[model samples]
Target: MEIDYSTIKVIGFDADDTLWVNETYFREAELEFAKLLSGFETPNKIDQELFKKEIGNLPLYGYGIKAFTLSMVECALELSNYTLPNATIEKILNIGKNMLNKPVELLDGVEEVLEQLSKKYRLILATKGDLLDQERKLEKSGLTTYFHHIEVLSDKQNANYSKLLNHLDINPSEFLMVGNSLKSDVLPLVNIKAKAIHVPFHNTWAHEMVTQKETSGKKYETINTLRDLLKMV
Candidate 1:
């Protein structure tokens, strides 16, 4: 079956790994966190527990470096049997600070793709994370002017996308989303009768990953690079 873009009036782009480096920093921070707690638990165990902690805290903390930092602190305390040193705690805080302060590195062809697409379609940014952090990265990326609207979503699900489309006064068939996360960016839009293009990043956070069974019969196109979007739409 052929997916049509003829009715697409708005093109939504995901930030973080879609437009810039994100998961890599988290991966790096996890490694550092594991090293900090190596005395109490092995690196592998620390990694597993931290992932669980992050997921468990999602409802309360939402998402971002600040939330991740808190999870690290809690995990450390538990892993250390509440005997974690102040110095180790401080190091954990620094991990989050460093991640927050890290530079935004845009993927190749991002600007080129946005510039071309914006001319023919209404471009909007739809990303999920801490509002301030996403705003800061957008400012740093220097791609803000291309977006007609910027949405920092609490989460990306079918309902969320449906609400967004409703707010825009557009039909579901008229919106198309492009992102690296199939779970957040692709499936929701697809499920809502909207179109989506998957532009995979090199690394995906564990939570963002979907199993083959989840994508078995999903109708979407996966491109190797953002540059490929130029030819498709």
Candidate 2:
């Protein structure tokens, strides 16, 4: 389907995988976490339990490395039946720290796409994670000047996007969001009658994965790379 971008006055970008590398580090950390707890459970079981812990903690802790660290620490204690060594707990904490300190690696063509699109439309960084960490990544990214606004949301649901558009004085029909997660970036905007474009990253978190049924009737466009934006919009 050919969609029109004529009414799109503002564009929102998802920070993590959409702009730079994110989920890859989480995958690495999970492996490290599994190895640390291998004595208590098989790697597969450790992975499954850790995912449950992260999802269960979402309501209280929200998203980001800090929350993931806490979940890993808790998982360790439980998996070891409260006999987990203090040293191992420390290792898990270090995992989160190392992830936070990882250098911000921008995706291919990110700067070029952002530079070109910023000229014709208002761009905003619409991402969800620990506020400080997200802010840190943006500062390190050196692409801050390209965005008109930056939002660190608690979650990316329809209501969240609706509130963001209202606060920015932008009509839903006049906004377009581009990102890697269909669950967060695309569906929410489509539900709010806004435009969305999916620019998928190679890796995705299990929690962000959506069923085909959910997206079967959703209206959005998918592009293979960020560079495609310049030609589309």
Candidate 3:
């Protein structure tokens, strides 16, 4: 189970929950969204339906707050049998706007870890989300300088990672990815013969979750915080 770090040349980082507070805000927005539609369905039902809608809409919208807001609006209309009011629709839009405007809050030791590691290995950001929103966060993050490359992927799959590694001319054995989602961050890299470290965030979107069966033979390291990465690399 020992992962050799001596061969790693390029380190990829997942942006959202790994470097900053992302899912926590989404959780808060979900609560607010549920409250807005409480008259149509209970909060629990709304949450379940919303998650279903998100999964169903993934191909069309991809990941990001805009897609989530659109899904929320669609769920509201469907739950109310298309009788949802304009006022409620407006409230949902406002919720998305609020999230977009919220300040970027970096997770503990994010900058320090990035700063320290950048001095050695080449750093790249391997994250997936809406391009505009991801660009906005990177701009606000103030940690942009540490990264040598930034990729905003439409999805994180083995093929996607292969393409990225190929584009960067990096060998799988010499690459490592760090992130919070096992499905997006760890499994894909492991499948591609690369190293991955899982830094779990307290809250994760339902869509990004994976069963133990899916990760059964995946080889990766799990760290409690970004600060712990300083010791690894």
Candidate 4:
């Protein structure tokens, strides 16, 4: 669907898979760590335990490879009768460290569109992630300057979206939520009467995926790439 960009004041974007690659490293690390502990437990069982820990501890630790590593290592140790030693801890820690150091690869045409759009509208970086990890990724990705406000949210609930819109001096009708997840980015904005453009991404973390209700209640725009958003907004 087409949008009149003239009416859209602030264009919001999700950071991780929306702009640059993330979550892949976490998946990779989990698989490798599971292999390392294969003697103790199956990967499926280990992943189940890790998923449980992630869901139950959502209030404690939001997101990051560090937490994932800790949870996996802790659960593995418990499951395996503490077979993992100090050396194992170091190994896991190094994996997370390597993830941090991995090159920041922005998705195709992210810069071109953001650069094009920034000149016209008030741009905001609206993303939910582990605060430290999120900030570092933004800095490294070289797209921070395009945004007037950068909000690092814990989660994108309706309350979170409402507070953010108010803080930016923008109303729901004037906002356009652009991101990958319908659960976090698109649907939450829809709850508040904000227009949203959903650009789907592969490899959605279990926590971020949501059921797609067939009814079209609010203004919903779906596209394949970040660059294509230019056509609508």
Cα deviation of 177, candidate 4, in Å: 1.1
Query: lDDT, candidate 2, residue 229?
Result: 89
Candidate of highest lDDT: 2
Q: What is the TM-score of each candidate against the true structure?
A: 0.99, 0.99, 0.98, 0.93
Off by over 4 Å in 2: none
Instruction: Give the Cα lDDT of each candidate.
Output: 0.94, 0.95, 0.94, 0.83
- What are the clashing pairs of model 1? none
> Which ten residues in a row are the worst by lDDT in model 2?
84-93
Question: What lDDT is reached at residue 7 by model 2?
Answer: 92
- Candidate 1 per-residue lDDT, tens place, 1-233, comes to 98888898999999999999999999999999998898999899999999999999999999899999999999999999999999999999999999999999999999999999999999999999999999999999999999999999999999999999899897988889999999999999999999999999989888999999999899999999999999988
What is the TM-score (0 to 1) of candidate 2?
0.99
Using TM-score as the measure, name the better of candidate 3 and candidate 4: 3
**What stretches of model 3 exceed 4 Å from their correct place?**
none
Relative to the unseen true structure, what is the C-alpha lDDT of residue 177 in candidate 4, on a scale of 0 to 100? Answer: 83
* Candidate 3 lDDT, 1-233, residue by residue in tens: 68889999999999999999999999999999999888889999999999999999999999999999999999999999999999989999999999999899999999999998999999999999899999999999998999999999999999999999999999999999999999999999999999999999999888889999999978999999999998888
Off by over 4 Å in 1: none
Off by over 4 Å in 4: 1-6, 214-218
